[model samples]
Target: MASNQASNNTQQESKFTLSMNHDMEQQQICLDHQQVEEKEFDYSKRSQWLRAAVLGANDGLVSTASLMMGIGAVKKDIKVMILTGFAGLVAGACSMAIGEFVSVYSQLDIEVAQMKRDNKRSNKIKGNNEDEKNVLPNPAQAAAASALAFSVGAIVPLLAASFIRDYKVRIGAVVAAVTIALMVFGWLGAVLGKAPAIKSSARVLFGGWLAMAITYGLTKLIGSSGL
Candidate 1:
């Protein structure tokens, strides 16, 4: 009778040990899943900033380069080209900054209003107001980021054309520089956004080329017509 009792106790202890192990394993799995979900959410949140920055840079590069090319079409002076590019860089940066600020401020206002309405609907539904507020966009930060990105991109063409004194060589240098920058920007945006690299690069390159061509052609036509 004592032997049987001892065996029964052993069996129960073994079962209890196995149960504890299973619970631990299940908890580990749950933790891993939660971590993965959080990582994905963080990545999605960061994508918005990446998209805005890439857009700002591309706009700055294309618009500034086009302006320089247009001016180069009319005037062969390197000084003139450089000056036009500098002016474009400053103006474009300011424009991008202001536009981003206004847009983001509007979005912030809307989000704040929505949050207020949601809070009024159900106190229990408000899980964490601090977390929600932390995720909200800052207009000033957006504006600064846009302005800095635009300035960085606009500098590319200015540096490329600065040293080349010959009109033809300067034009070629500007084109080459702009092409490379466009490809880099597109590839970067694609990689970050998980889009097709080839399509993104091709689209950006083609758009840049089109803008420069149109600007150059129009300016040349106008100058030639003495208008």
Candidate 2:
């Protein structure tokens, strides 16, 4: 009888041990799932900012380079080309900042309105919820980031043509530098957004080249025509 009792106790302990192990396994799975979800959310936020930066940089680089190329085609003076590029950089940066500010402000208003509606419908107090506030976009921050990115991109062509004295060489340098920067920006954007790197790079590179070519060709034609 005592032996039977001992065996029953052993069975109970074994079952308890199995149950604890199962619970632990379930907890581990839940934890891993939560971690994965958090990681993906973080990545999504990162991708958004990276994409914005890439767009701003690409705009700055292409516009400034095209302006320089156009001026070079007509004037052939390094000072004129540099000045044109600088003007374009400043104007583009300010434009980007203002545009981004307005766009994001509109978006922020829409989101805040939606959040307020949701809270009202759910009978929740409209408190200063940190989580809700954190998710909202800041117009000032967006504007600053956009301006900074545009300035950074616009400087590339300016620097590339700064030292070259020969008009032809300066144009070539600007083109080469803009091409490389476009490719890099495309690749970085693709990597962050999980897109095809080669395709993105090629598209950006060709677009930049086309813009510069068109600007140069048109300016040259106009200058030659004395129009």
lDDT scores for all predictions? 0.95, 0.92
**Candidate 2: tens digits of C-alpha lDDT, residues 1-227:** 99999999999999999999999999999999999999899889898899789989999999999999998888988888889999999999999999999999999999989988887788675465557898799999999999999999999999999999987788778988998999999998898888899999999999999999999999999999989
TM-score of 2: 0.89
Candidate that scores best on TM-score: 2
lDDT of 1 by residue, 107-158 (tens): 9999999999888887734458877999899999999999999998999999
Clashing pairs in 2: none
Instruction: Report the number of the highest-lDDT candidate.
Output: 1
Off by over 4 Å in 2: 126-131
Clash pairs of candidate 1? none
